[model samples]
Target: MLPFVLSAALLEVVPSGKVPSSIPTASSTATIPTVMITRGQEQTVTPDWSRLSFANLPAITQSGSLNGQKWSAGQPVEKLLTLGDFQDSFKLQDLNLYAIAVATQMPIKLVKLSQFKLLAGQTLADLALAVPELEQLPVSTVKPLSDLLKSAKPSYRLTEKTLPQLLEQDPTLGALSFQNFDLTGYTLDKLPGLIHAPLQAFRHWQEAKLTDIPGLREMPWQQFPNPPSDSSMSGVIQLPTTMSYRLGKDSTSISGSSALGYQIPCAGCTSITFSDPPALQKKRWISGLAQWVQGGISDVAQSTTHSEPTGRNVFGKAFKVVVTEVSPKQAQTALYFRFCQFQQQISCSPYAIGPVPFLSYRNGELMPVGNLEIGTDRSITPQMLPSVKQILPTIPTEIPSTVNHWSELLSQILEQIKALLHPPATPTA
Candidate 1:
């Protein structure tokens, strides 16, 4: 399967080698072949074809068919830019790797590519993936990232600006398209700009480090693709079918009252009636692009609240997301965040929380699926204990019929007290 990834870089030098007579040398009908030298080999190679080597090739030509373009179109040939053009090298990820083995002409060897001078601030390491010859260049001649300047360790690196600039230099260079080549140059945080990146047939993003960057979901792009409907890619669109949230701990827990239906209303969703014929379309669009998303966490939403352990707590439910993949599209991943629960949580435990945003392209246009919940784990429900009333220690409250009719007794006692206080009153009493 092809992935939509492309890249660009400097042309490599061809090593010296003896020419195989069967190989065609050029585009014109010349009798004598030309001499070309490669970089790694020790001998020179001579070929019998004209200087117009790949000019007559067709779209699916045996010469080389990359990203649907034949050698006759001259893109691959142009992408194999002259070594003198190295100061502004870009990537060529648009080529269909399976069909990019072009038989070269003589006097024009891959080795000649390495003789070009690099720009002042260019990172030579950035081109190593597309052109492995950079690894052989001496540190003095090929200045890489600042890290290479150190006397201790001399590992090279490309900056966030590296890829974008390379693509800017050559529009013909594919941005991230190497299917078989290794892209050790790019890091998780240093993704190439999407606007200049080329569309690919099959792309595997799992290899890139994408976990660290923030605001990844909202990156800008000139064009993006819609998710493909290929069943094999369905896993890429994983979303929660039902979402459950546990707000407060223990006695102070809050649970859905069932009657209200378990869901937090999505903002601006009041106008939507998801009835059978549905008042709203399942997808949303802005500009000419369709909206597709992978995440929508509470933090990215309107707001959220705190929770305590024992008092009445706010409990609510949110709807799960369902994402359908798009096709021929290059998607951009914008980051939200997540508290991983089941398998792996981003921040917290027991429940996975999040809306990890990712843009999908269909036919190279962004899919407008609206805010999607990209990350969702198991539904977590709080454990609660039954409530009980306290009882006083066993003191008997039973009384017989003769128990206390103190009305008469109280009157007698009052009279006796009065007589004692006053002697005349006592006599009358």
Candidate 2:
């Protein structure tokens, strides 16, 4: 969704020593908002870079500029262009600025997004004030820019009611991809006739059923649809009934179904994995296909990972954790578990359950260790060596149907166990 800085190898816990206040406690997921510390940070950021055609472009340092504007790292884009500009313009930079430039009949430079807020009657006329070069353009030349800012009844939601009206005013809007459309969540009664439909359009829209869209057929499970063009809207989009993914012809693959009985994007998370890059590299590819779930599209999905154990060892072993997610018919039994040998990343697959291990700070990095043993009373104990037969059956793996509750429970337990494993050293006398 956003660019991530692969600032370090892994997040290491300071074992019973003087810990910097800036570093979070072993139990505290209260993460620093910094991009480098989060899990799958590099994975999250990779898709954005793919939008750029020119490789070897210098990084966006604090001193970077866009079209000669003094844009710096973390600068609020609104200071240069409205959200409308972002959604309509900058969002499509990879396509080159030609279409919008011609539409406005003025110089089309980079810009940034507006939301349903624009459905409230916002226009792009104020753009001249944001970009100094546009100040001298005639109102006539900029008329198309304003025309591009379409609006509907402020009262209309993104539903069957709103779609026809927007199309009635400008049917071409339907041709716009999901990324160009600002609003989401509601499903139209039918697919727009003019939609530039994909062979597998179901993978892109939320709440879409095969019956609702014309000229489509059932997608085979062997195919991995391309990642969604606008993954930022993932957290809000609907998924299909089944999906699958693979990075290459030979990579480890995964497939999942909605009939298994649990919701998707549970707690704004689906799956994660770990990997160790070469010692001198500054960035690494996140090693899982579920990162595609970063866009929140597709149902009946499958994910894949590297088959080999490819990361530094912890506790004399290298391994990876695969969290298998299923679709919801009912609330219980959301995801199952599998233990893949450790590699450089995490992945979510489908089917099966076993002991899910926890990570510990090792050699100045956080590494997955033995499983956390579960008690009959559901108490959790950290085990230096996992006893799968004894621990697996005891796992209260009956994850709650509600996402927030499950997230909260896991957060609380993880913090408690981490605190126990690496207690803060007592203050010096």
- Model 1 over residues 47-141: C-alpha lDDT tens digits? 21233222321111112211122232212222322211111111122421111222121122221212111211123333434343333444343
User: Which 10 consecutive positions of candidate 2 have the poorest summed lDDT?
Assistant: 306-315
Predictions: Cα RMSD each: 32.3, 23.9
lDDT (tens digit, per residue) of candidate 2 on 1-429: 112111122111122222212211223211111121223322211112222211111211122222223334323222223211212112221221222223233221222222112211212222222223333343223323322333322333343223334445555444433334443332221112112222122222212222222211111111112222332223322212112221221122121111111111111122222234322121111211222111100121122210111111111111122222212211001111122211232222221211111221222232221111111111112232123222112224344558797566555545543422211112121
Quote model 2's TM-score. Answer: 0.17
Per-model TM-score, in order, reads 0.19, 0.17
Candidate 1 minimal-lDDT segment of 10 residues: 420-429
lDDT of 1 at 117: 17
TM-score: model 1 vs. ground truth: 0.19
In candidate 2, stretches whose alpha carbon ends up further than 4 angstroms from where it belongs are 1-125, 129-133, 140-429
